[model samples]
Target: MWVRDDVCGLGPYQADLVETYWRWEQDPASLIGYGRQQPESLEARTEGIAHQLRGDNIRFTVYHLTDGTPEPVGVTTLLPDPSVRTAEYVVMLAPEARGMGLGTAATRLTLDYAFHITNLRMVWLKVLAPNKPAVRAYERAGFRTAGTLRQAGYWLGQVCDELLMDTLSSDFSPPSVISPLMP
Candidate 1:
Protein backbone atom coordinates (compact mmCIF):
# COMPACT_ATOMS: atom_id res chain seq x y z
CA MET A 1 0.00 0.00 0.00
CA TRP A 2 1.25 3.54 -0.70
CA VAL A 3 -0.13 5.54 2.19
CA ARG A 4 -2.78 4.37 4.64
CA ASP A 5 -4.11 7.23 6.73
CA ASP A 6 -7.42 8.15 8.34
CA VAL A 7 -9.31 9.72 5.44
CA CYS A 8 -8.14 7.33 2.70
CA GLY A 9 -5.40 5.05 1.51
CA LEU A 10 -3.77 4.23 -1.82
CA GLY A 11 -2.31 0.91 -2.92
CA PRO A 12 -0.41 -0.02 -6.02
CA TYR A 13 -2.72 -1.38 -8.70
CA GLN A 14 -2.93 -5.07 -9.32
CA ALA A 15 -4.67 -7.23 -11.92
CA ASP A 16 -7.12 -8.41 -9.25
CA LEU A 17 -8.50 -4.87 -8.99
CA VAL A 18 -9.32 -4.58 -12.70
CA GLU A 19 -12.96 -5.47 -12.19
CA THR A 20 -13.32 -2.85 -9.47
CA TYR A 21 -12.05 -0.15 -11.84
CA TRP A 22 -14.32 -1.37 -14.63
CA ARG A 23 -17.29 -1.09 -12.28
CA TRP A 24 -16.40 2.46 -11.22
CA GLU A 25 -16.24 3.61 -14.84
CA GLN A 26 -19.75 2.30 -15.40
CA ASP A 27 -21.20 4.96 -13.14
CA PRO A 28 -22.75 7.82 -15.15
CA ALA A 29 -21.41 10.38 -12.73
CA SER A 30 -17.95 9.00 -13.36
CA LEU A 31 -18.26 9.56 -17.10
CA ILE A 32 -19.18 13.23 -16.95
CA GLY A 33 -15.99 14.63 -18.43
CA TYR A 34 -14.67 11.46 -20.01
CA GLY A 35 -16.37 12.12 -23.39
CA ARG A 36 -18.17 8.77 -23.60
CA GLN A 37 -21.46 8.47 -21.77
CA GLN A 38 -21.09 4.71 -21.64
CA PRO A 39 -18.11 2.87 -20.29
CA GLU A 40 -15.97 0.43 -22.21
CA SER A 41 -16.26 -3.30 -21.59
CA LEU A 42 -14.11 -5.02 -19.03
CA GLU A 43 -11.82 -6.40 -21.68
CA ALA A 44 -11.18 -2.98 -23.15
CA ARG A 45 -10.64 -1.45 -19.75
CA THR A 46 -8.32 -4.30 -18.83
CA GLU A 47 -6.16 -3.52 -21.83
CA GLY A 48 -5.76 0.00 -20.51
CA ILE A 49 -4.93 -1.35 -17.08
CA ALA A 50 -2.33 -3.58 -18.63
CA HIS A 51 -0.86 -0.57 -20.38
CA GLN A 52 -0.71 1.24 -17.06
CA LEU A 53 1.39 -1.62 -15.77
CA ARG A 54 3.80 -1.29 -18.65
CA GLY A 55 3.85 2.47 -19.06
CA ASP A 56 4.84 5.47 -16.97
CA ASN A 57 1.34 5.76 -15.58
CA ILE A 58 1.05 5.59 -11.81
CA ARG A 59 -2.24 4.05 -10.78
CA PHE A 60 -3.63 3.23 -7.37
CA THR A 61 -6.73 1.95 -5.65
CA VAL A 62 -8.33 4.27 -3.13
CA TYR A 63 -9.43 2.62 0.08
CA HIS A 64 -12.37 3.68 2.19
CA LEU A 65 -11.56 2.77 5.80
CA THR A 66 -7.91 1.85 6.32
CA ASP A 67 -7.48 1.02 9.98
CA GLY A 68 -8.69 -2.57 10.21
CA THR A 69 -8.67 -3.35 6.50
CA PRO A 70 -8.79 -0.76 3.78
CA GLU A 71 -11.90 -1.16 1.69
CA PRO A 72 -11.58 -0.19 -1.98
CA VAL A 73 -13.58 2.91 -2.81
CA GLY A 74 -12.18 4.27 -6.06
CA VAL A 75 -9.28 4.60 -8.51
CA THR A 76 -6.92 7.53 -9.06
CA THR A 77 -4.28 7.79 -11.73
CA LEU A 78 -1.44 10.00 -12.85
CA LEU A 79 -0.72 9.66 -16.54
CA PRO A 80 2.64 11.29 -17.13
CA ASP A 81 3.50 13.48 -20.08
CA PRO A 82 7.17 12.58 -19.95
CA SER A 83 8.35 15.25 -22.33
CA VAL A 84 6.89 17.97 -20.14
CA ARG A 85 7.44 16.44 -16.74
CA THR A 86 3.73 16.87 -16.07
CA ALA A 87 0.84 14.48 -15.62
CA GLU A 88 -2.87 14.26 -16.20
CA TYR A 89 -4.71 13.50 -13.00
CA VAL A 90 -7.90 11.49 -12.97
CA VAL A 91 -10.05 10.07 -10.18
CA MET A 92 -13.33 8.21 -10.03
CA LEU A 93 -15.43 7.08 -7.07
CA ALA A 94 -18.11 4.46 -6.56
CA PRO A 95 -21.66 5.79 -6.55
CA GLU A 96 -21.99 5.15 -2.83
CA ALA A 97 -18.82 7.14 -2.25
CA ARG A 98 -20.12 10.24 -4.01
CA GLY A 99 -21.07 13.46 -2.17
CA MET A 100 -18.66 12.52 0.59
CA GLY A 101 -15.15 13.99 0.86
CA LEU A 102 -13.50 10.81 -0.43
CA GLY A 103 -12.70 12.26 -3.86
CA THR A 104 -10.97 15.24 -2.34
CA ALA A 105 -9.08 13.11 0.12
CA ALA A 106 -8.07 10.68 -2.57
CA THR A 107 -6.98 13.55 -4.78
CA ARG A 108 -4.73 14.97 -2.11
CA LEU A 109 -3.16 11.59 -1.57
CA THR A 110 -2.58 11.19 -5.29
CA LEU A 111 -1.11 14.72 -5.50
CA ASP A 112 1.17 13.95 -2.61
CA TYR A 113 2.38 10.94 -4.54
CA ALA A 114 2.70 12.93 -7.74
CA PHE A 115 4.72 15.79 -6.34
CA HIS A 116 6.59 13.95 -3.63
CA ILE A 117 7.21 10.47 -4.96
CA THR A 118 7.14 10.86 -8.73
CA ASN A 119 9.13 14.09 -8.86
CA LEU A 120 6.68 15.55 -11.36
CA ARG A 121 6.55 19.30 -11.78
CA MET A 122 2.83 19.60 -12.36
CA VAL A 123 -0.39 17.60 -12.21
CA TRP A 124 -3.34 18.77 -14.28
CA LEU A 125 -6.92 17.79 -15.08
CA LYS A 126 -9.74 18.79 -17.38
CA VAL A 127 -13.27 18.85 -16.04
CA LEU A 128 -16.55 19.67 -17.70
CA ALA A 129 -17.87 22.91 -16.28
CA PRO A 130 -21.10 21.21 -15.30
CA ASN A 131 -19.32 19.10 -12.73
CA LYS A 132 -19.20 21.81 -10.09
CA PRO A 133 -18.72 19.44 -7.20
CA ALA A 134 -15.78 17.76 -8.88
CA VAL A 135 -14.28 21.11 -9.77
CA ARG A 136 -14.67 22.16 -6.17
CA ALA A 137 -12.96 18.98 -5.02
CA TYR A 138 -10.05 19.62 -7.38
CA GLU A 139 -9.76 23.17 -6.15
CA ARG A 140 -9.83 22.03 -2.53
CA ALA A 141 -6.95 19.72 -3.41
CA GLY A 142 -5.00 22.84 -4.56
CA PHE A 143 -5.65 22.97 -8.32
CA ARG A 144 -6.24 26.31 -9.96
CA THR A 145 -7.84 27.10 -13.29
CA ALA A 146 -5.30 27.62 -16.02
CA GLY A 147 -7.86 28.19 -18.76
CA THR A 148 -11.20 27.10 -20.19
CA LEU A 149 -11.98 25.74 -23.60
CA ARG A 150 -15.39 26.90 -24.76
CA GLN A 151 -17.75 24.07 -25.67
CA ALA A 152 -14.90 21.65 -25.64
CA GLY A 153 -16.75 18.80 -23.98
CA TYR A 154 -19.76 16.86 -25.13
CA TRP A 155 -22.10 15.19 -22.62
CA LEU A 156 -25.50 13.63 -23.20
CA GLY A 157 -25.72 15.27 -26.64
CA GLN A 158 -24.91 18.76 -25.39
CA VAL A 159 -21.63 20.57 -25.73
CA CYS A 160 -20.28 22.06 -22.55
CA ASP A 161 -17.30 24.13 -21.60
CA GLU A 162 -14.24 22.52 -20.03
CA LEU A 163 -11.98 23.87 -17.39
CA LEU A 164 -8.26 23.20 -17.48
CA MET A 165 -6.92 23.20 -13.96
CA ASP A 166 -3.53 22.34 -12.56
CA THR A 167 -1.49 22.16 -9.37
CA LEU A 168 2.26 22.40 -9.42
CA SER A 169 4.80 20.79 -7.09
CA SER A 170 5.10 24.13 -5.33
CA ASP A 171 1.38 23.95 -4.54
CA PHE A 172 1.90 21.00 -2.25
CA SER A 173 -0.45 20.58 0.69
CA PRO A 174 0.48 17.14 1.92
CA PRO A 175 -2.32 14.63 2.24
CA SER A 176 -1.46 14.01 5.87
CA VAL A 177 -0.35 16.24 8.72
CA ILE A 178 3.34 15.73 8.02
CA SER A 179 4.87 16.97 4.79
CA PRO A 180 6.31 14.64 2.19
CA LEU A 181 10.07 14.34 1.83
CA MET A 182 12.04 17.17 0.22
CA PRO A 183 15.59 18.44 0.28
Candidate 2:
Protein backbone atom coordinates (compact mmCIF):
# COMPACT_ATOMS: atom_id res chain seq x y z
CA MET A 1 0.00 0.00 0.00
CA TRP A 2 1.07 3.60 -0.57
CA VAL A 3 0.80 5.07 2.92
CA ARG A 4 0.06 8.73 3.58
CA ASP A 5 0.61 9.70 7.20
CA ASP A 6 -2.27 7.56 8.57
CA VAL A 7 -4.85 9.54 6.65
CA CYS A 8 -5.27 7.32 3.56
CA GLY A 9 -3.60 4.61 1.53
CA LEU A 10 -3.97 3.11 -1.93
CA GLY A 11 -4.41 -0.60 -1.51
CA PRO A 12 -4.58 -3.14 -4.29
CA TYR A 13 -8.08 -3.44 -5.65
CA GLN A 14 -10.00 -6.49 -4.46
CA ALA A 15 -13.19 -8.18 -5.68
CA ASP A 16 -14.75 -8.09 -2.25
CA LEU A 17 -14.64 -4.29 -2.44
CA VAL A 18 -16.96 -4.14 -5.44
CA GLU A 19 -20.02 -3.56 -3.30
CA THR A 20 -18.37 -0.59 -1.65
CA TYR A 21 -17.52 0.90 -5.02
CA TRP A 22 -21.01 0.25 -6.32
CA ARG A 23 -22.48 2.06 -3.36
CA TRP A 24 -20.31 5.08 -3.98
CA GLU A 25 -21.07 5.08 -7.70
CA GLN A 26 -24.78 5.08 -7.00
CA ASP A 27 -24.80 7.65 -4.26
CA PRO A 28 -26.60 10.80 -5.49
CA ALA A 29 -24.18 13.00 -3.62
CA SER A 30 -21.27 11.25 -5.22
CA LEU A 31 -22.90 11.45 -8.63
CA ILE A 32 -22.96 15.21 -8.39
CA GLY A 33 -19.25 15.40 -7.78
CA TYR A 34 -18.52 12.72 -10.35
CA GLY A 35 -20.71 14.47 -12.91
CA ARG A 36 -22.36 11.19 -13.72
CA GLN A 37 -25.51 11.77 -15.69
CA GLN A 38 -27.15 8.71 -14.25
CA PRO A 39 -26.58 5.91 -11.77
CA GLU A 40 -25.81 2.39 -12.94
CA SER A 41 -27.86 -0.64 -12.01
CA LEU A 42 -26.18 -3.38 -10.02
CA GLU A 43 -25.62 -5.48 -13.12
CA ALA A 44 -24.00 -2.65 -15.06
CA ARG A 45 -21.93 -1.52 -12.12
CA THR A 46 -20.67 -5.04 -11.49
CA GLU A 47 -19.76 -5.47 -15.13
CA GLY A 48 -17.78 -2.25 -15.00
CA ILE A 49 -16.01 -3.43 -11.88
CA ALA A 50 -15.16 -6.64 -13.70
CA HIS A 51 -13.51 -4.66 -16.46
CA GLN A 52 -11.28 -2.89 -13.95
CA LEU A 53 -10.41 -6.16 -12.23
CA ARG A 54 -9.53 -7.73 -15.57
CA GLY A 55 -6.65 -5.26 -15.91
CA ASP A 56 -8.29 -2.90 -18.37
CA ASN A 57 -7.30 -0.09 -16.05
CA ILE A 58 -5.02 0.60 -13.13
CA ARG A 59 -7.23 0.93 -10.07
CA PHE A 60 -6.88 1.12 -6.31
CA THR A 61 -9.23 1.16 -3.38
CA VAL A 62 -8.69 4.20 -1.20
CA TYR A 63 -8.78 3.50 2.49
CA HIS A 64 -8.85 5.75 5.52
CA LEU A 65 -6.85 4.61 8.51
CA THR A 66 -8.48 4.68 11.88
CA ASP A 67 -6.02 3.80 14.62
CA GLY A 68 -4.18 1.74 12.01
CA THR A 69 -7.20 -0.11 10.65
CA PRO A 70 -7.87 0.78 7.01
CA GLU A 71 -11.48 1.45 6.03
CA PRO A 72 -12.23 2.04 2.37
CA VAL A 73 -13.31 5.58 1.64
CA GLY A 74 -12.85 5.97 -2.11
CA VAL A 75 -11.29 4.69 -5.36
CA THR A 76 -8.91 6.01 -8.02
CA THR A 77 -8.30 4.77 -11.54
CA LEU A 78 -5.98 5.54 -14.43
CA LEU A 79 -7.51 4.67 -17.76
CA PRO A 80 -4.46 4.38 -19.94
CA ASP A 81 -3.87 5.06 -23.59
CA PRO A 82 -0.73 3.00 -23.76
CA SER A 83 0.23 4.03 -27.24
CA VAL A 84 0.89 7.54 -26.01
CA ARG A 85 1.97 6.62 -22.51
CA THR A 86 -0.79 8.73 -21.04
CA ALA A 87 -3.91 8.10 -19.00
CA GLU A 88 -7.01 9.79 -17.71
CA TYR A 89 -7.14 10.06 -13.94
CA VAL A 90 -10.44 9.48 -12.21
CA VAL A 91 -11.30 9.51 -8.51
CA MET A 92 -14.44 9.13 -6.43
CA LEU A 93 -14.69 9.87 -2.72
CA ALA A 94 -17.42 8.09 -0.78
CA PRO A 95 -20.28 10.38 0.15
CA GLU A 96 -19.36 10.32 3.79
CA ALA A 97 -15.70 10.80 3.02
CA ARG A 98 -15.83 14.15 1.18
CA GLY A 99 -14.36 17.41 2.45
CA MET A 100 -11.61 15.60 4.34
CA GLY A 101 -8.82 15.93 1.71
CA LEU A 102 -8.46 12.17 1.20
CA GLY A 103 -9.08 12.61 -2.53
CA THR A 104 -6.20 15.03 -2.87
CA ALA A 105 -3.90 12.83 -0.85
CA ALA A 106 -4.87 9.83 -2.93
CA THR A 107 -4.28 11.72 -6.18
CA ARG A 108 -0.79 12.71 -5.11
CA LEU A 109 0.04 9.16 -4.16
CA THR A 110 -1.34 7.84 -7.43
CA LEU A 111 0.60 10.45 -9.42
CA ASP A 112 3.77 9.21 -7.83
CA TYR A 113 2.85 5.66 -8.70
CA ALA A 114 1.84 6.54 -12.24
CA PHE A 115 5.06 8.23 -13.15
CA HIS A 116 7.44 6.19 -11.05
CA ILE A 117 6.01 2.69 -11.09
CA THR A 118 3.78 2.74 -14.13
CA ASN A 119 6.11 4.89 -16.26
CA LEU A 120 3.50 7.12 -17.78
CA ARG A 121 4.23 10.34 -19.60
CA MET A 122 1.19 12.35 -18.52
CA VAL A 123 -2.10 12.14 -16.62
CA TRP A 124 -5.21 14.14 -17.27
CA LEU A 125 -8.72 14.55 -15.90
CA LYS A 126 -12.02 16.26 -16.64
CA VAL A 127 -14.08 17.65 -13.80
CA LEU A 128 -17.32 19.54 -13.63
CA ALA A 129 -16.64 23.19 -13.03
CA PRO A 130 -19.28 23.43 -10.36
CA ASN A 131 -17.39 20.84 -8.35
CA LYS A 132 -15.03 23.39 -6.91
CA PRO A 133 -13.82 21.14 -4.15
CA ALA A 134 -12.68 18.49 -6.61
CA VAL A 135 -11.01 21.04 -8.89
CA ARG A 136 -9.11 22.50 -5.97
CA ALA A 137 -8.04 19.06 -4.84
CA TYR A 138 -6.66 18.16 -8.28
CA GLU A 139 -4.74 21.43 -8.43
CA ARG A 140 -3.28 20.77 -5.01
CA ALA A 141 -2.05 17.42 -6.24
CA GLY A 142 0.22 19.02 -8.89
CA PHE A 143 -2.16 19.28 -11.84
CA ARG A 144 -2.46 22.47 -13.85
CA THR A 145 -5.27 23.64 -16.09
CA ALA A 146 -4.84 22.35 -19.61
CA GLY A 147 -8.04 23.79 -21.03
CA THR A 148 -11.80 24.01 -20.45
CA LEU A 149 -14.88 22.67 -22.20
CA ARG A 150 -17.40 25.43 -21.69
CA GLN A 151 -20.86 24.20 -20.64
CA ALA A 152 -19.99 20.67 -21.39
CA GLY A 153 -21.65 19.11 -18.38
CA TYR A 154 -24.94 19.24 -16.57
CA TRP A 155 -24.85 19.51 -12.80
CA LEU A 156 -27.75 20.17 -10.46
CA GLY A 157 -29.97 21.03 -13.43
CA GLN A 158 -27.62 23.68 -14.72
CA VAL A 159 -25.23 23.43 -17.60
CA CYS A 160 -21.67 23.56 -16.31
CA ASP A 161 -18.26 23.82 -17.88
CA GLU A 162 -15.78 20.99 -17.67
CA LEU A 163 -12.27 21.87 -16.70
CA LEU A 164 -9.38 19.97 -18.22
CA MET A 165 -6.30 19.53 -16.08
CA ASP A 166 -3.12 17.56 -16.54
CA THR A 167 0.34 16.94 -15.17
CA LEU A 168 3.37 15.63 -16.99
CA SER A 169 5.89 13.27 -15.44
CA SER A 170 8.42 16.12 -15.30
CA ASP A 171 6.01 18.50 -13.60
CA PHE A 172 6.93 17.35 -10.09
CA SER A 173 10.20 16.99 -8.28
CA PRO A 174 12.27 14.04 -9.51
CA PRO A 175 10.89 10.71 -8.32
CA SER A 176 12.85 8.78 -5.71
CA VAL A 177 10.91 5.51 -5.77
CA ILE A 178 10.33 2.89 -8.44
CA SER A 179 8.32 -0.35 -8.56
CA PRO A 180 7.80 -3.38 -10.79
CA LEU A 181 4.52 -2.24 -12.37
CA MET A 182 5.77 -0.81 -15.62
CA PRO A 183 3.60 -0.22 -18.68
Candidate 3:
Protein backbone atom coordinates (compact mmCIF):
# COMPACT_ATOMS: atom_id res chain seq x y z
CA MET A 1 0.00 0.00 0.00
CA TRP A 2 1.13 3.54 -0.68
CA VAL A 3 1.33 6.03 2.18
CA ARG A 4 0.51 9.59 1.37
CA ASP A 5 2.09 12.57 3.07
CA ASP A 6 1.39 16.21 2.45
CA VAL A 7 4.60 16.56 0.49
CA CYS A 8 5.40 13.19 -1.08
CA GLY A 9 4.28 9.60 -1.33
CA LEU A 10 6.07 6.70 0.36
CA GLY A 11 5.79 2.94 0.66
CA PRO A 12 7.43 -0.08 2.20
CA TYR A 13 10.30 -1.31 0.05
CA GLN A 14 10.13 -4.45 -2.02
CA ALA A 15 13.19 -6.59 -2.74
CA ASP A 16 12.50 -6.66 -6.46
CA LEU A 17 12.80 -2.91 -6.74
CA VAL A 18 16.27 -2.87 -5.27
CA GLU A 19 18.09 -3.01 -8.59
CA THR A 20 16.39 0.06 -10.00
CA TYR A 21 16.97 2.00 -6.79
CA TRP A 22 20.51 0.67 -6.73
CA ARG A 23 21.34 2.03 -10.17
CA TRP A 24 20.12 5.45 -9.16
CA GLU A 25 22.43 5.54 -6.18
CA GLN A 26 25.27 4.01 -8.15
CA ASP A 27 25.38 6.93 -10.49
CA PRO A 28 27.84 9.19 -8.67
CA ALA A 29 27.28 11.84 -11.30
CA SER A 30 23.88 12.32 -9.74
CA LEU A 31 23.05 15.28 -7.55
CA ILE A 32 24.19 13.46 -4.44
CA GLY A 33 27.76 13.00 -5.54
CA TYR A 34 30.31 14.89 -7.60
CA GLY A 35 31.04 12.43 -10.41
CA ARG A 36 32.92 10.22 -8.04
CA GLN A 37 33.40 6.49 -8.38
CA GLN A 38 30.59 4.33 -7.07
CA PRO A 39 30.44 0.98 -5.38
CA GLU A 40 31.53 -1.85 -7.68
CA SER A 41 28.20 -3.60 -7.39
CA LEU A 42 24.62 -2.46 -7.03
CA GLU A 43 23.89 -5.51 -4.96
CA ALA A 44 26.44 -4.41 -2.41
CA ARG A 45 24.87 -0.99 -2.01
CA THR A 46 21.36 -2.40 -1.85
CA GLU A 47 22.32 -4.91 0.81
CA GLY A 48 24.02 -2.24 2.84
CA ILE A 49 21.02 0.09 2.80
CA ALA A 50 18.70 -2.83 3.43
CA HIS A 51 20.75 -3.85 6.43
CA GLN A 52 20.41 -0.37 7.81
CA LEU A 53 16.68 -0.57 7.32
CA ARG A 54 16.45 -3.78 9.29
CA GLY A 55 18.77 -2.63 12.05
CA ASP A 56 17.50 -1.26 15.34
CA ASN A 57 19.18 2.10 14.91
CA ILE A 58 17.31 3.48 11.92
CA ARG A 59 13.89 3.83 10.33
CA PHE A 60 13.90 3.83 6.54
CA THR A 61 11.30 4.92 4.02
CA VAL A 62 11.26 5.15 0.25
CA TYR A 63 9.65 7.94 -1.74
CA HIS A 64 8.23 8.07 -5.23
CA LEU A 65 7.56 10.97 -7.51
CA THR A 66 4.22 12.78 -7.07
CA ASP A 67 2.81 10.63 -9.89
CA GLY A 68 2.65 7.66 -7.51
CA THR A 69 4.68 4.94 -9.25
CA PRO A 70 6.34 2.03 -7.51
CA GLU A 71 9.73 3.16 -8.76
CA PRO A 72 11.37 5.15 -5.98
CA VAL A 73 12.71 8.60 -6.60
CA GLY A 74 14.21 9.08 -3.16
CA VAL A 75 15.03 7.54 0.19
CA THR A 76 14.92 8.83 3.75
CA THR A 77 16.41 7.45 6.91
CA LEU A 78 15.70 8.47 10.47
CA LEU A 79 18.31 7.46 13.00
CA PRO A 80 17.28 7.65 16.62
CA ASP A 81 19.72 8.48 19.31
CA PRO A 82 20.19 6.19 22.27
CA SER A 83 17.37 8.01 24.06
CA VAL A 84 15.05 7.19 21.14
CA ARG A 85 13.16 10.44 21.71
CA THR A 86 15.52 12.32 19.43
CA ALA A 87 16.73 11.45 15.97
CA GLU A 88 18.60 12.59 12.91
CA TYR A 89 17.33 12.43 9.33
CA VAL A 90 19.04 12.03 5.98
CA VAL A 91 17.31 12.35 2.62
CA MET A 92 18.56 11.90 -0.90
CA LEU A 93 16.65 12.41 -4.09
CA ALA A 94 17.60 11.56 -7.62
CA PRO A 95 18.95 14.39 -9.72
CA GLU A 96 15.85 14.43 -11.86
CA ALA A 97 13.57 14.36 -8.83
CA ARG A 98 14.90 17.51 -7.25
CA GLY A 99 14.21 21.24 -7.74
CA MET A 100 10.57 20.57 -8.55
CA GLY A 101 9.61 21.26 -4.89
CA LEU A 102 9.65 17.57 -3.96
CA GLY A 103 12.42 17.99 -1.43
CA THR A 104 10.59 20.57 0.63
CA ALA A 105 7.33 18.63 0.50
CA ALA A 106 9.01 15.37 1.40
CA THR A 107 10.90 16.98 4.24
CA ARG A 108 7.83 18.54 5.78
CA LEU A 109 6.09 15.20 5.61
CA THR A 110 9.07 13.54 7.28
CA LEU A 111 9.07 16.15 10.00
CA ASP A 112 5.43 15.36 10.73
CA TYR A 113 6.23 11.67 10.96
CA ALA A 114 9.18 12.34 13.19
CA PHE A 115 7.26 14.54 15.54
CA HIS A 116 3.76 13.04 15.66
CA ILE A 117 4.02 9.38 14.73
CA THR A 118 7.04 8.95 16.94
CA ASN A 119 7.81 10.13 20.47
CA LEU A 120 10.47 12.46 19.29
CA ARG A 121 11.14 15.84 20.86
CA MET A 122 13.69 16.95 18.35
CA VAL A 123 14.54 15.97 14.81
CA TRP A 124 17.96 17.02 13.64
CA LEU A 125 20.15 16.64 10.59
CA LYS A 126 23.52 17.69 9.30
CA VAL A 127 24.16 18.92 5.81
CA LEU A 128 27.42 19.72 4.15
CA ALA A 129 28.08 23.44 4.45
CA PRO A 130 28.57 23.87 0.72
CA ASN A 131 25.10 22.49 0.00
CA LYS A 132 23.34 25.83 0.06
CA PRO A 133 20.23 24.67 -1.77
CA ALA A 134 19.57 22.05 0.86
CA VAL A 135 20.21 24.54 3.64
CA ARG A 136 17.67 26.89 2.16
CA ALA A 137 15.12 24.13 1.80
CA TYR A 138 15.57 23.11 5.43
CA GLU A 139 15.09 26.69 6.58
CA ARG A 140 11.92 27.06 4.55
CA ALA A 141 10.63 23.87 6.11
CA GLY A 142 11.15 25.19 9.68
CA PHE A 143 14.52 23.75 10.60
CA ARG A 144 16.81 26.17 12.40
CA THR A 145 20.54 26.03 12.66
CA ALA A 146 21.41 24.22 15.83
CA GLY A 147 25.16 24.48 15.31
CA THR A 148 27.99 23.39 13.02
CA LEU A 149 30.62 20.73 13.28
CA ARG A 150 33.91 21.94 11.92
CA GLN A 151 35.93 19.58 9.79
CA ALA A 152 33.37 16.92 10.49
CA GLY A 153 33.35 15.48 7.01
CA TYR A 154 36.40 14.71 4.94
CA TRP A 155 35.19 14.32 1.39
CA LEU A 156 37.18 14.36 -1.86
CA GLY A 157 40.28 15.82 -0.22
CA GLN A 158 39.80 18.76 2.14
CA VAL A 159 37.77 18.73 5.30
CA CYS A 160 34.39 20.39 5.46
CA ASP A 161 31.97 21.40 8.17
CA GLU A 162 28.52 19.93 8.57
CA LEU A 163 25.76 22.40 9.37
CA LEU A 164 23.69 20.97 12.15
CA MET A 165 20.00 21.87 12.00
CA ASP A 166 16.98 20.93 14.05
CA THR A 167 13.20 21.19 14.41
CA LEU A 168 11.25 20.59 17.56
CA SER A 169 8.06 18.56 17.78
CA SER A 170 6.27 21.57 19.25
CA ASP A 171 7.23 23.51 16.14
CA PHE A 172 5.49 21.15 13.71
CA SER A 173 1.88 20.42 12.72
CA PRO A 174 -0.08 17.82 10.77
CA PRO A 175 -1.14 20.39 8.25
CA SER A 176 2.54 21.10 8.17
CA VAL A 177 2.83 23.75 5.51
CA ILE A 178 -0.12 25.93 6.49
CA SER A 179 0.55 25.76 10.20
CA PRO A 180 1.46 28.95 12.02
CA LEU A 181 5.09 29.43 12.79
CA MET A 182 6.11 29.08 16.41
CA PRO A 183 8.26 31.57 18.19
Specify the highest-lDDT model's number. Answer: 2
Q: Whole-model Cα lDDT per candidate?
A: 0.84, 0.85, 0.68
> What TM-score does structure 3 among the candidates reach?
0.78
RMSD of each: 2.2, 3.0, 4.6
Writing each residue's lDDT as its tens digit, candidate 3 over 37-139 gives: 4465775866776786568654344565446564467766678886658988877677777787766766777676677566689989888777777888788
User: Each model's TM-score, in the order given?
Assistant: 0.89, 0.90, 0.78
Decide which is better by lDDT, 1 or 2. Answer: 2
lDDT of candidate 1 over 39-127, digit per residue (tens): 68898988887777887778888988845777888889899988998999988888888788998889998888787677899999999
lDDT-based ranking:
2, 1, 3
State candidate 1's TM-score: 0.89
**Model 2 TM-score?**
0.90
lDDT of 2 by residue, 1-183 (tens): 764445778888888878888898899978877777777888887787777787879998898886577888989999999999999999998889988889888888888889887899999999988888888999988999999999898899999899999999999654333343443
Mark the regions of model 3 whose C-alpha exceeds 4 Å error after superposition: 5-7, 29-40, 57-65, 68-71, 82-84, 154-157, 173-183
CA deviation > 4 Å runs, candidate 2: 2-5, 174-183
The RMSD (Cα, Å) of candidate 2 is: 3.0
Model 1 misplaced regions, further than 4 Å = 174-183
Better of 1 and 3 by lDDT: 1
What shift in Å separates residue 162 of candidate 3 from its native position after superposition?
1.3
